[model samples]
Target: MLLRFTTLSALFFAYTLAWAQQSNSLFFMHRIPQSNLINPAVQIDCPVYVGVPFLSSLHLNLNSTGYSYNDIANGTGTINFPALVGQMHSWDYLSEELHYTPVSFGFMYDNDQYFNFAWTERVESKLFVSKRLMSLFANGNTQYVGNGLVTSNPGLNSFYYREFSFGYSTRLRGDVLVGAHAKILFGLAGLYTKRNSVDIEIDALTHNINARWNPQVNVAYPIGVTTDAAGNVTGVSAGAFSPLPFSLNFSNPGLAFDLGFVKPNDPITWSGSILDLGFIWWLKSTSRFTNDGHFVYRGATPADLTNPDAYIDMLADSINNQVQFQHSNGSFVSFLNPKAYFGGTYAFTPQLLAGAHVRTEWYPGRPVVGLTLSAIAMAKKGSSVSLTYSVMNGSFANIGAAFNIGGESFQFYILADNLLAPFYPERVRNANLRFGFNLFWGCKQKKKKLSIPESSGGGCFWTWGLDQKRKQHGVK
Candidate 1:
């Protein structure tokens, strides 16, 4: 009863925030999402006050753990759910969130590939207008929604998920900037299977079943037909020759926010290095709502099997009432969105920069701290290279090199991460390689700074229209 009630409540909350809560952690460059300790505006590679850049990035992440599931068969933890193995069960999310204008659009995909020949896929897309739009609705606020799951073959392969987010920033004064993001969520699950079973009527209190049926257990049984005592018809199962695994799909979106600040160098005062700081606030996270029902196939009498619809109604009714979910199952953890870090970049020399950053993520209480060192060679042209080392439960590192032609006309880059993983997975390692090229089709020179004149204000002659007034004053 407790489990059922909690599941229902999760479903309710998920519905309330379904489109707002999502996770996109697959990309390594998601510094803003992974570590919210710095103002994203300041991190823009292009000149500020300019247009947003066109950007595309791809990232692949892999996670695995070893454990035993006694409930399945002895303590073996064999693949009872074949489709839930390998890629399907791997917890990784993908997103495209860097776009132009005050609005942004992002798509996220997550899947768990645990068992071979079985798989799950989830896709999510988000559209964000300025949070200022909140005033347009009542309470001066409105919720955002995103889609995160799709089931193609149904029972053979299923996907599940949750996501939500929002961000904002404004100028406190010249050189001081602040911003934040908020998110909300909900989720659901779908299941499809080639095989099924039937349970016969028994005393509700005693829990003694009078009969039982197993649709398929071995290659001989397959999934097309079932028999009774007289070898009579019981169930019709198709798709046996094609052999598809049972599948389920779920989606949830939630709400969270991030606040940040940027303090750039001040040439007139202290020539100090640029400083970046950020804070993220995540709340109201919910999980997926797997339908709570036992299904039935052909030839099962009403008394022979419990009504699947009744179970669904009961769960829905529980949702109508408020409740909280439990995480007793494997891989389930205490839920809360964690705050993270995002500040870095300190210049040690005219051509050299070094910085450090730290961030904490939810679900596993994992903390990552990293340092980056980069240098540009002094030459007629320009060349630069950078190396980053991150330490967490495991150590991760990356190396990147950039070459420039004619100072700004042409550029080439090569980047790699987790190079050490190939040498050691258990000893601590991870890696990837990336390359990029950029060129300008047209050349335009920067305009020279103009000098303004200062008049009777006793300021420099190049202030406002002061140059003309200075001539008049000299004549007088």
Candidate 2:
């Protein structure tokens, strides 16, 4: 029975790893308007810009704290479970997230203030697993006969939602730029664990299994539930399938805010931001599933072990008969994962700069921190490229890169935290990509003064303006 439970947990863990979250490479690329998503104070030089509807901005992220795909699969394309389990830490996590912007636009006001609006759809999921549980799955329970096993509660959290945000930024005293984003969120579906105290213990002498499983899981999804005469949940069924299960839902609403500031001092600059500090209340189609108390089972006999198929069926029957699920409808609150950033940059020249950034992401457990160093080069035509190196999530080989290319009227850009993941996915533990297209207008460029010498004829020789001199000198 424990083995069966472990198997199901492993499957769910794999499913969550398919998608992941967030991109740090976009933080330093100020040439792209999307950079403001991370730091609202980041100002785009253009006076006005509009995203190209669905093609505007799309982001996808996938990562694992324990191991990469290569760690499990061998050259012959077979899984090495023991090797995979050996490389796992005491607690490992798999996370996935996606963000898509269908509508977005921004404009600068009076060369001092900026305003923008966007509507985005987001999906995020995470799973936490313990090393002991994985070991039992890889190696059998017999190895842990003498030394019993105790594991922390393994849980999963997933949700889908939509966000409509309005942002404003203005220059403060001493040219300090400050900004904020007020967001309204509508949650569509979610599966969250409210309480978990599920533990399994094996007796050293008698080989008896004692399991104390009392978990409360809250779900807000569109599905039908089956119940018995006594109101106990018997089964769940999905009547019809939809490609996008939670397309739009307004029943669960919430509010969030982001605050940021940028301070410029001569050739050096400082910036900081706090993002997504808010929560959502799940109220529609919400249900809670929970169990009662403890259950004990004797070790499997020799004959039962020999016929594994029969033993599995017997175990299933035993579990169904002993463990009863109680279902109830109730509303619950879920908080958004918040992130903080603090960084500074040094200008080497008019078109080149170097920067260092520190980011911390807060979760229910421990906060994940990362350090990134980047070098950026900009062109006069509103184009730029950046290269970065980051250290985070216990994996150090993070080489990030970003580029923006286009004239003043249109632009296309791509930013990635780990470019190597696409080629050698099995070798890297982190991967994220953000790409978009936008139309830009009224990009202001600084006008340089021309130094012309006076002729011997006196008074003032005929001299052209800076713009005319640039044309005569073949300057762009």
Candidate 3:
């Protein structure tokens, strides 16, 4: 019940006041090494760029499709739960995800290939509680004596770990580029329920309430756990724990791969990528819990409507005493939810570029899909800025922006999608921001000439191979 309520509180804002996982504005800011994370095929002019480690990249994103702040806010700026419930639909579910990258960097090899690496962390959560269930919790089981209420897939999953990634990108030939990033993941702490289905049945006359819980809960390095008489986890753990920065957890290991392709053309550049195709294996210090049987709640005496607190206590005590968890220890493999990106950019001028892309994130629940249109204004001195409009998870009010300010040797960049949610915190459902600094080398061209034309360097489409101007010799 505690975990369930916590997840509900997270859903109240509909995951608003948080960032979107797919920062559309940053993804197209090619001048920043960060774009490579979205599309490995993207190349930066810098031959080498190292992140400041811990300060290099900090990212956070939270988004939802079920509800928004506007649905609950009244003229008084107060929370109205009953009002929020009216905006919910039967099929609507709350889903949210977050990612943080504390360490990252990229280096380009003279051989025309780029090597990039980073350590990334992630958290994902989702819940779909039935209206009947909420009503029962709020009003009581007396209203619906015969109708069974279900709290479907109520889960809050936490994954704390680090990802060491090695990425490589190069030009296959003229007008073509390819890249791939392979990742090795180390799980420090995790709690997930791969399978969960719960239902509450109320007896009309007997007033006996029955709860059917069927779930397979997995935990890694969990704290504050209490087992039942049969070794089942009647009480679960919740809170935050910090993990070692560089140590390896032999028990928790996983792998992921990212592949991208760029087809540079005359006026237009086409690019696409498939991200996070991988899975993790949990081994050491892991536990799995499942319900031993069912729990029947008849209350202490008769259904006491005057004092709700007593009824709740009775329900909890009954559950703890009746429902035993079967604990088992072993290993488990969990697959990563993948995402696909496809977009094309048009060069309006040598300094201006516009593009549109589609991003689809595949999860265990419903997939998150969106369309983004972006434009970038590149400066002659290697500085650049971008703006974007995105429509995700069936909402169409996401407006984002990005800017890179720095010299060839050092670069500072920031990006945000769904930026409006912060100011109008009372009406939006998604928000995010990503910022970082990098030390770069060789962003500017070297005096030495190479086999590839100077114009073929990184930047807009029409400008490829057009960097060199003639000496302008004249008759004496």
Candidate 4:
């Protein structure tokens, strides 16, 4: 049975791959709106900074859904278009509508650390904003009449959402830095439709079906179909696709926060740099809100029971009630619970920094080491280019570079990660490129001189707090 399941999954994935080729408007990522969770510290100088930069990054995310007890026995088949199940009356009346989309394009600006040297102690902060578009696709096996076997058929199309987010961060003293971000997400941007289309295939029959089956599949499910007063399908309806279990036209607004610290020291013989440690946690993400209300079936005549429309109402109520489609109520919900990732950076030299990060969720499971690498660079004090080659886990490797325009008064920088799109430190080669740039302007003041007894450092530790007496008598 496991072998059979694996074979089915393989076929589904392959079908998805082929189907993806035809989907031009599908979103490929879901983490776009929450990219600030990666690295919050973008260079923090004296506030105002700007630079023109473009980047692209691509990665693949796989999730398991739609596998109910029935799916286990009949082969996993979940429908993306509720209208298909509605038209065919295939859904069992009491199951929540399942929505599952795989792959999306994730990209962000300002996903790094910003070191501040303007204050007494160097200040640091992280800032970022990003968005991802998710693709809408369905995978499952279809059972034909007169056939005891099932075959996997994956359908992919232009279903997706757009997200916008902004984050800010800054350091406390020289050790603690805190940051947070909020996002506004708008979903279901691409609408598609397919109806009354059929394709007949002449192939070797694996299942023993002597009769021809309707191979017509709808590409986009229409939102509201033409229906009689009693809610029976009256004709093909047209408009925003409806009965699509998930609401695409809703907005989700949520917030996330990050706190990190680094203890810098001149331990041993290392100079100009020290060890840096940090930890980050993300609160539960908010989900798009939609109407849970159902459509009420209306009939004027008492004989509506046998009027066809009445019976359709009964089915609609059963299926519609059982399967709740998410609505666009302009509100929000929550997706995953709180999660966290911890990491550390050790600078062995002014031009070389090494670090590793581990990710864990509150749920019981092994903590996964996302990445580790040593960053190396060569340059003078005013200008330098650094490269970091890192591996997440043991398989994926990524090469990143950051160039700085440094001086006494101010500084400027540009960075590129996954200079190859989508391929990050964790993934060998993903599609999409990720890049960012920043500018900093600051002025440092010279340390002030204080008159005190040579025997005591400035003032006695306790006497410095005595105000008038300490100022008049000094450290006598």
Candidate 5:
């Protein structure tokens, strides 16, 4: 569990990933074929689109609300433990989401129906902390000799998996569009933790600490891991993971569903979707640990502070003596974080549209609710550009943009949410970017154009009056 927590945090810092990588900026870019990734119900006019295999999407996100880099160090690069503590909240936490797409494609079927598929790998994790836990680790418990602290809030959850998806969409009667997607999931790795309750109190007279702790942890590892007499890991498992086909082994399997709808009312379109409603069962190389009852700590003496190493050793010994972890081997099931979206767009003209959306994405104990306003400029040649401003969670200052360069045979698109993070991390807490290339086929015309004699001196306009309307519209 310690390794799982620390390693995930290191990866976020090492990669400098941020929170706003859900590709929200591309949602309104109508001409971009990738818009469907945001909402399966979003039907673009693309007849066929084949993504550039592994280049389809690579996304990373880091979630946090406390301790920006500057909070821990002043401009002179000096460690300020006091400053860092001051910047922390009652609960400080961080999480990450990573995604890699191996293959993706979309095609229109039965004239009005759209079909799409994709294979993706995903990793998601969240690390939580309580102020009491932080103070206990940093300043020690003696500082608050009489304080009763609650340290049960700390939590950690991480999951890794692979997903294969199939989606279909078609227009219903009265021009109402409906879509649904089914996902098959394969679990690769996981660490799930639940803290039932914890309470701690320090007796002012004797400086004796009484603690009540209850927690549960479950994990999955590759084969050949050695355990000690107490079920503690004595050695790390060795080997690289194999990306074998999911069907080769169904040791871990899960299912999910996504449903979406779009209703176009002339100048306005209303859209909504429910996404990632799913779960996965883990059966391979799984284990769980649980702890209950009380742990006591005789507060550190004044002399103990002089030798930091001795003090830590004593604390570790005390914790081990009091907290008995019961280990068990078992299979467990986990659920995916689901999301909901509602949005509407108003078209001022055929080429200009303004839209706003309310999108909610959830984590174990956190739900991110975002509101975004976007404007898209669509071109007749299947090109588009969009700008967006979003407010989400407790932090704002999220600005995003997307530009799609379209051609007859190929399309390239770039999208970013929270543009400020790339340039100024200090002021931006969330950031994201998504780019991809797709080769596509356009809609096929069902009815051929009528042949009209140019020599007639007057084209199909003789009686239809359409030529006059076209001339009025400056169609030439």
Candidate 6:
């Protein structure tokens, strides 16, 4: 069981390290309609906008708090296990986030209010593990003969869901613009652990092992499990069961909300938001598995030290014989990872601005935070270019750039948090990218000021002055 779980985690970590999350680059691009995903208070210049189906927005992010690829692998395509283990913290996390919007549209109403709708699909995954637990698996228990090993709160939380959102933004007193998104969520699949604990001790003289395991896991996926007569799970088959596709899963429902505000004051603008405050009660095709077992193994002898394979096989068999899992159908609840943003911008000119942004995401174990500073240049035709420097996920080499190019009828934009990650993948810990296309209409520009008439050539001003003087003197 330990080997299988470790292998699966390692594979997932490796796969997600190459892909990438909420992008800091997009947070400050107010001209892009999709920027509302980060801060709903952001209002696009166009009076009406529609997102291209399936191509409006795509977001992907991958991050690790423990070690990067370079710390584990050498230049010669060899993995250095000891080096990787040495760089790990007491507790580490690996996370993946994805968002794709299929349909979205917005229109201005009452001249001061905006209303929008969107259908989005999202996936989130996070894995937390203990360093000592990893060391116990990698280096063996010989070093811990008397003390043994104890690990707590090591587990995985992953889920897939769809969101149908209705949003509104309106101007308030003091020229403050406030907005919110009310979302209805449908869960498709999930895997979560409520409790996970492991304790093991070996006698100093006899090397006898005493172990206790208490783990409870909940699953809501489409699969069939095979169990032995003793109620121990032995195998799993995916082809044995069929379920509705993710797009059609409405049995598991939830709700969420996002609130934000933007305050503009001449050259300075302030903005903040709180997003994804919600939970899903999973009641469809859910199963709960729990195992609480304590056992002793007195089969180890001094002679078995020379043959490590035989000793490992003996230990595995003892565990299998002692531990049995209890399974039942039950409902579970999982919460969405919430995030917050606080930021401000300074406009040096009508066409140029500088901004600083702070973002935080609350996960299970710890909160992840990032800071970004950016400069944006806007064109009169509603196009923009931005460059940014960000410090995120323990990586300092993040240099980002974005561009929005289009005319009155259509727009296309691409935003990324770490443009260098693809080229220098070994040096960075995380990467994110968002891109989309949209159709726009009734784009309004800054109204131009009317020029004053010259006094020397003013034919109407002289007559107006003479008429005012005659009226003051009572001579009509």
How do all models score by TM-score?
0.36, 0.86, 0.81, 0.38, 0.81, 0.86
TM-score of 3: 0.81
On a 0 to 1 TM-score scale, where does candidate 1 land against the true structure?
Answer: 0.36
In model 5, what lDDT does residue 142 have? 76
Candidate 2 Cα outliers beyond 4 Å, as residue runs: 1-5, 11-21, 76-78, 136-152, 239-248, 444-476
Model 3 lDDT per residue over 1-476, tens place = 42345346535544344234576787667878888888888766555678777778777766655556666655466655566556554434455565667788776564456678887776666544445445565456787677776666455566666687889888776747799999998777677766456677889888778877776778877446676565656566654544553245556888999999888776677889999899888876788776645777665654576778988776677656676667777677777778999998887765688999999977555576789999889875567988899987556788889998873678899888777877876666667778888887654534343233324433442123112211111101
Ranking by lDDT: 6, 2, 3, 5, 4, 1
Query: Model 5, residue 79: what's the lDDT?
Result: 49
* lDDT by residue (tens digit), candidate 4, 96-177: 1112212112112122233211100111111100000001112222232232222222212232333333445443443234
What lDDT does model 1 reach?
Answer: 0.27
* C-alpha lDDT score of every prediction, in listed order: 0.27, 0.75, 0.68, 0.27, 0.68, 0.75
What candidate 4 gets wrong by more than 4 Å, as runs, is: 1-12, 15-37, 41-43, 53-170, 182-222, 225-252, 263-339, 359-369, 378-432, 437-476
Winner of 3 and 4 under TM-score: 3
Give candidate 6's whole-model lDDT.
0.75
Model 5 segments more than 4 A misplaced: 1-19, 71-92, 131-153, 204-207, 223-249, 444-476
Tens digits of per-residue lDDT for model 6 on 308-337? 898998878877777777777899999888
Each prediction's number of clashing residue pairs: 70, 4, 10, 44, 1, 5
* 1-476 per-residue lDDT for model 2 (tens digits): 34565566665444333323456777877778888899998666556789988988999886787666666664445666787678777777778788899999998765567899999998987777667777876885666786667665567789898999999988777667789999999998899975365577777788687778776778988678899997778898754646564575688998999999877765567888999999899998898888775677786889998999999888888887777788888999999989999897787765677889999987556577888898988775668899999887767888989998983679999988887776876677788888999997664333543233232011111112223323423344
Per-residue error at 93 for model 1, in Å? 16
Model 2: C-alpha RMSD to truth? 6.9
